[model samples]
Target: MKNNWQLYVLILPAVIYFIVFNYFPLYGIQIAFKDYKAASGIAGSAWVGLKHFENFFNAYYFKRLLSNTLLLNVFNLLWSFPIPLILAIFLNQIKSPKRKRFIQTSIYVPYFISTVVLAGMLYIFLSPTSGIFNIMRTSLGMKAVDYMSEAAAFRTIYIISGVWQTAGWGTILYMASLAGVDTSLYEAAEIDGASIWQKIRYIDLPSLVSVAMMVFILDCGKLLSSNTDKALVMQTAGNIPTSDIIGVYVYNVGLGSGQFSYTAAIGLFVNLINFILIMSVNKLSKKVTDVGLF
Candidate 1:
């Protein structure tokens, strides 16, 4: 008991954080089942049961909102999920430590740029007139197109910019995991006359599986979640259909339109789904690889 005291002390801060940031806010979820009025506050709010939930389920925007959120998540899963693995593998193959550090530093710079600044830069670069992209199009005798206003381009821009900003930062964890892989495995593979590709395929990839699965599970849990600020900053009326993800939709309902109860209900539902996804993925991971967050 005396020896375990330090471990409890180490966990005290996280326990406090969850109490303050997570458990306390659970009381507010009741607002979803009430006709909440800011003047009356949460305690005095009139209970309406599942009225708000029903409203959201039957709302005209339900299908579009759900479709947009799921599609964006799918796109992220398909495209963004594997990038760090590939980057980490390629970066690990570089023999020069100095050159590797330089490349990593350069790649990581984009992640530190504020979302507002990054979105502004994207807008300027993709603008129809006086933008470099359009200028190049015109130079090539093609018509200059306004990419920011185009629905088809919204997902492309969001995914590509997201990859540019986060891929390097993501690689850091995978690279660390790769570094911890036993060098003896590689030596054994080489002694067995395994080619470099075979060494990577049989040895390096297996070592990466646990880290990769953990990351994938985390990503899946956030499938319907996004940063409202980034989405709003990048959104335009013309591209709203493509860019209006769950976070932005919630922001619009609660803060923008004052549909507080409805937004609460929707947000609660989204969080529940996320929770289920995390649990399911964790269980599956345990079954498949004998590794899980639990």
Candidate 2:
């Protein structure tokens, strides 16, 4: 028991952190089931049971919100999930240490750029008036289109920007995994007259499978979330129909309109879905690869 005391002491900070930032906030989940009035406060708020959740479920925007949220996640799963893996694999194949370092540094730079700055850059680049894109359009005898106002263009812009911002940063984990791979495997493949493609398929890919699965599971857990800051920056009245994701919706309801309890219910619902997805993916990963965040 005395020996175990030091271990508990070491974990004290982490336990405190979860209590303060995570577990404490969970008490507010009750807001989802209450008519939470700021004047009345949490204790004084009327218990409304499932009324707020039922309201959200029956809201006119429910279908559109669900569709937009699911579509964004699907696009992210399809396009964003594989980019870092491929980038890591390609970067690993580079034999020159100097070139590898340079490539990694260049790619990760975009991630450090503030979301506001990045969105502003996008707006400038896609601007219809006095912007490079529009200038090129006119030179090519094409119509100068306002991309920010177009519903069809919102998802594409969001996805592409997401890839550019995160793909490089995401590769760091896979690169670390690749670094731990035994060089003897590659040497043996070479001695067996295996082609580069075959070596990658059988050796590199297998080595990376666990890392990839972990990343995929983490992304699945965030399937319903979009960065509210970035979405807000990109959003305009004209683009809201397509760009209004769950996070953005919560921000609008809670902060913009002061519908605190309503937003809490919606946010809680989104988080519940995320929790289910994470558990589901974790279970599948454990079965398939014996690696999971237990």
lDDT values, one for every candidate? 0.89, 0.91
Show the colliding residue pairs in model 1.
none
Could you tell me how far off, in angstroms, the CA of residue 22 lies in candidate 1 after the best superposition? 1.3
User: lDDT at 270 for candidate 1?
Assistant: 95
**Candidate 2 residue lDDT tens string, 1-294:** 686999999999999999999999998989888999999999899999999899989999998988988898789788899999999999988999999999999999999999999999999999999779899999999999999889889999999999999999999999999999999999998999998789889988988888899889998998888778888899988888989887888888889899999999998899999999999999999998898988
Q: Clashes per prediction? A: 0, 0
In the range 1-294, model 1's lDDT, one tens digit per residue, is: 697999999999999999999999999999999999999999899999999888888988888888988888889777789998999988987889999999999989999999999999998999899899999999999999999988888888888899999999999889999899888988888789998788779877888998999999999898888766887898998999888887898887789899898899999999999999999999999999998888
lDDT of model 2 at position 190: 92
Q: TM-scores of all models?
A: 0.95, 0.94
